[model samples]
Target: MVIDTATTSGDTALKQKVSSLMSTLKSDLCDLVRIRSTAGGATTEAANKVVSLLKEAGVSDATTVKIGSGRAPLVHGTVTGRTGKPTVLLYAHYDVQPAGSWNETEAFTPTEVNGRLRGRGAADDKSGIMMHVGALRAFDKNPPVNLEILIEGEEESGTGSLEEYLAKPENKDRFKADAYVVADTGGIAVGRPALTATLRGIAQADVTVRTLDAPVHSGMYGGPAPDAFMALTRILATLHDDKGDVAVEGLLSKPWTGADHPDETTYRQNAGVRCGVPLIGTGSVAQRLYFKPSINVTGLDGAPPPVHKSLNALQSEATARVSIRLVPGQKPADAVAALRRHIDQHRPWFLPVEVTYAGGGEGFEARTGSTTFAKAQAALQEAYGQAPTTLGQGGSIPLVNLLQARKPDAPVLLWGCEEPAARIHAPGESVHLDELERMTLAQALFLKALSQQ
Candidate 1:
């Protein structure tokens, strides 16, 4: 629920300043989006662009730090204010996921259609990088709060160098702040503001089923011979019950108590659920999505394609990869172990399967009702004209868990312009200019608010 508030005096000035930077922000965002900063892509160029933009925004001591070999460089910069004022660490990433197939729209070409800018990294964090720039620009490069900016280059790939940098004794004060603002998250919708208070972690494993050492002729042994593909499918099918809730035992499920969840119809439309196909899981969308653990079948091996199918043969081996999003309070190791146990207990026909676990990250749950959170709520309300809703993102940022551990005293704030329609990390990704404008103003206001006390 949102509490309405009248426009404040400071917001009046903030709006004017943000309005003035719209054109420049748009042009700069387009240029930054054009840089290919995907994992294993041209990160050097992207880091250079970020440093240049930070310099132009009046940041001092802008530099890049490349940790271990193969790790992308970290763009570090800072802006100092009055000595007594509070300091804030602004975090964002210059890197993005690889641009998948662009059916019609070109990836990395920032095209403006209607009021949205479309391109790779336009929303799931080039918009974030520009948000920091736009906010700093609004303050005329001398923000009311002491500003420290860290734009990472390997966030999409999870290099963990930023955490390493913070751990060093020399870099201890570099990120010491009263509050940390990460702009890689999203609002509930285009114009609605939100603060992500929780993030789900991930656990993965590869499961293989081998029914026979070699392929057998279905024409000769069709009834007696068991198909590995069919056996794997049956095992996977048992992961979900008739209602689609995860049937795995011992996984966490704490119902979401934040903003009203998207209704079934809205979710169906967004997910492109086929007509008459019931949605997976039960309860409110927020409950099922944000609170409960979710398992996704990400990949399959040894599955013959339609054109390559041979009807007379039964496959000897089949493998599948499963990824589970762990809800807050569930440890990754425990989740992985539970998943293996569930698989072993539920396999059809007592079929033996191989389960290999992969590395996983822990989920994070932020403490609410703190002074910093209140200040953020006020800032978001001043900019968006309504109380910000507390939210839990379905996705995980491993770095956030690390940051929370490193800076336990400073509250981490997550709010960005990316909405559901942004389609971030997917083809035709885009961000609405109006949302970006409001988020910039909110960040500026947040810094000012933090400086007050």
Candidate 2:
């Protein structure tokens, strides 16, 4: 769809303005990345920094507000536009994941290599914050639509307080909007614009298996005694079939009908799959990733490192943290129950097994076919020179569901700068400069289009 000549000219000018502010955007993003705002870490500092940036970008009322006890601060602000104009809430997270041993550079130390900025939060979400800031700055702080900025601090930590805050009757007016721009998700690939239409929910549990009262000597009891570690592994092995499909019953799944995923070669490269390692599961890649339930043993706490602390003893107890990703139709609680039932039915050797609920959140499926979504697609197409496509993320963003619940009428637009190569939540995380620029421009154009509507 071709934008009118006048709109195209304005978009050209806005694009130039966004280009001019790229340096500032990069600087602000790098500074934000330097904060170690992991789930329970320096999120307050990151939120405050975002508040300061928002104010500098013309959100004069921007300030950090506490949501709940033990939860990170939330940054809130608004830019009032012309009377009768539709409101748009800009959303992104300031918190980041902990830096594991995978980063090429210090997770807190932002580095610019080639055309990418490398840091922990640089891609996952810190860039999302900067994208909103850049788009507002492009409009010189006076956007065409009424703008509300909600930069979250605990999104990576399960968004505990925001849920309660939004549920209050008095807070409804604060978030009333015609559209919600959730900049926490990303495109399908660099320079390929895409909107995330669905997100998988998460259900996790800590399963403990106790085989004996205490550790026993391997040589003395190896023949007759059951090992807790072995029993735990056996229980986990039942989660998948021979083809790697989830073996758990009662979990909901359906075929994906969105844009096709990247070819196997590209997907393997993007996912950093080891050479010769086959991609597991059946059906289309998109279906496996976005429409089906998958289980993973995220952490184990029974066996010592064999290479460093090998012991000639059998463990008495073993515990594993299992994470299950759920599709849109499934409830988190129901999924957890199904998982428990599966483990109970598959326990080996009658070992004593206990399951403890970890945390979980429901998935989201955006309401498409709205005027706001259409404008967003047009804006992306204009910015990238290609039509935008729809995609679904396997990861969970709890706040998306909460915000949707609060404002069911508002169309939620999920797009960002973290493409496949950005490596979000993994080592060597980075965001392409071009992707950031295009997204910022697209956001600015989208808001302008909304104002005209």
lDDT of each: 0.84, 0.87
lDDT of 1 at 257: 79
Worst 10 residues of 1 by lDDT: 1-10
lDDT by residue for model 1 (1-453), tens: 233245668768888999999999999999988888888888999999999999989887898877755458889888775789877888999898877787423788899999999998999899998899999899888788777888998777765667566567776555667778889988878888899998898877898999988888878876687889989999899888899999999888886878665667777776678998877888888888788889999779967557766467787899998888989878878987888899899887898988888656778888776888887888888888777778888888767766666568889888898988888877889999999999999898888777777
Best by TM-score: 2
Kindly report which residue pairs in candidate 1 clash with one another.
none
Candidate 2, lDDT over the whole model:
0.87
List the candidate 1 regions with Cα displacement exceeding 4 Å.
1-10, 158-174, 210-227, 306-316
Off by over 4 Å in 2: 1-7, 103-105, 168-174
Candidate 2 lDDT for residue 262: 63
